[model samples]
Target: MATHSSVAHANLTVRQTLLHQLFGDHHGWLFERLRARLGCPSDAADMASETFVQVVALDDPHSIREPRALLTTIAKRLMYASWRRRDLERAYLDALANEPEQFAPSAEQQVMAVEALIEIDRLLDGLSSRARAAFLYSQLDGMTYADIARELGVSAPRVHQYVVQGLRACFEART
Candidate 1:
């Protein structure tokens, strides 16, 4: 019987071989497709590489019947995530720009803030737009339920429900 180490090595070898084949076959096509959409060669290269990295993490890379389609799906997700992160950073910077310089956070604090925002965004990803808005308004702005309801054009009770949903999402994300 194969030793456990040897079995693990075999699995690793299989994953590497599968990744090599997929990369060799799809990297160029994926790069060009991303480049055309993004209008940047470097970004396309990075996205393509990230797409392959996602594929490598799959439990059954050999089971893929539509390689290009899978690659496209993965790359699109990576692109969207990259865009979201950029948007978050831009919004954070815009908010910071409005603050007094004396009260400004350090560069490291800014980075940590952005990262926390991203985490919160991810935690709230399952929420509806209105629900997310309600949660942010309550948590970040300390808005009352009635005020959130007015802002969201919903009843105060409905706003309460949204806040509850958002809280559940955050709780679920933690576990």
Candidate 2:
């Protein structure tokens, strides 16, 4: 029993030793070829190391018929990884470009723009039914609210209400 155990242990050790030798002997050759194909030395070396690590971890290491072909496949996978990284980088850069600048507008311009918007809202709110309808029709539909009331046969107030309710609902939904 001791002899059998000892022989099995020795065989396992030999197999590990053989794998290590094979890895070291082909490491540089594979890396160089990968580097030439990939156009990057550091990337090639990293990928080659990863490929050998994968090869040794497989259940049937000896079943691989062509080491060179296996290495090439690994290289292709690494190239795909590189492309994915680059694509993510491009998307990030594009998003960064569209980000708002971290600065306030000129105080006078900011105040003026806000004041104009407030006045416009106030004017819309203060209009009489027919007047407001006319205003909205002229502003939104390029028609006089008189025309809208004439078409709908309702008071201009009703038309203004419809526009206000629609606008209010849209704003509320957004919020």
Candidate 3:
């Protein structure tokens, strides 16, 4: 009879074997598919690797019946996230471009600011467009509910609700 440690080791070995087999069977196909969609071999390779990483995080990889469909879904989500981050960074840089040289952030500060923005974006992921806009306008632009309502073409109470919803999302994300 196997000891507890031996049984755990055997289970780990089995999971590793399954993961290796899955990677070997699908990595090339996924890489080529991504390459075709992205038009960049390096980006395709990175996306394929990230896709497998997501698979590895699954509780039961063996239960997947349609691997390609799952891989495509995961890759598309990653691609969208990448595009969003790039857009955020570009916008931040454009804003900074208008600042005087004396007030320009250092490279490290810029990186930290971008990372913080990404985290904020993740925290606000499920908010509606108006809710997000209301929250940003209120918090960043110092707009009142009346002003936000006028800008969003909604009632002041509705703007208040949106701002509260945005705050709730951020609070839940923190916890």
C-alpha lDDT score of every prediction, in listed order: 0.92, 0.68, 0.94
Candidate 3, 1-175: lDDT as tens digits? 8899999999889889989988999999999999999999999999999999999999988788998899999999999999999999999999999999999999999999999989888888899999999998998889999999999999999999999998999888879
TM-score (C-alpha, index-matched) for candidate 3? 0.94
Which residues of candidate 3, in runs, are more than 4 Å off?
Answer: none
Superposing every Cα of model 3 onto the true structure, what RMSD results? 1.2
lDDT of 2 by residue, 14-53 (tens): 7688678778778888999988988889888888988888
Q: Give the lDDT ranking, best first.
A: 3, 1, 2
- TM-score to native of every candidate shown: 0.92, 0.49, 0.94
The residue-by-residue lDDT of candidate 1 on 70-153, one tens digit each, is: 999999888898899999999999999999999999999999999999999989988899999999999999999999999989
lDDT of 1 at 8: 96
Which ten residues in a row are the worst by lDDT in model 1? 14-23
Number of backbone collisions per candidate: 0, 2, 0
Tell me the deviation in Å of residue 24 in model 2. 3.1
Off by over 4 Å in 2: 2-8, 101-175
Candidates 2 and 3, the one with greater TM-score = 3
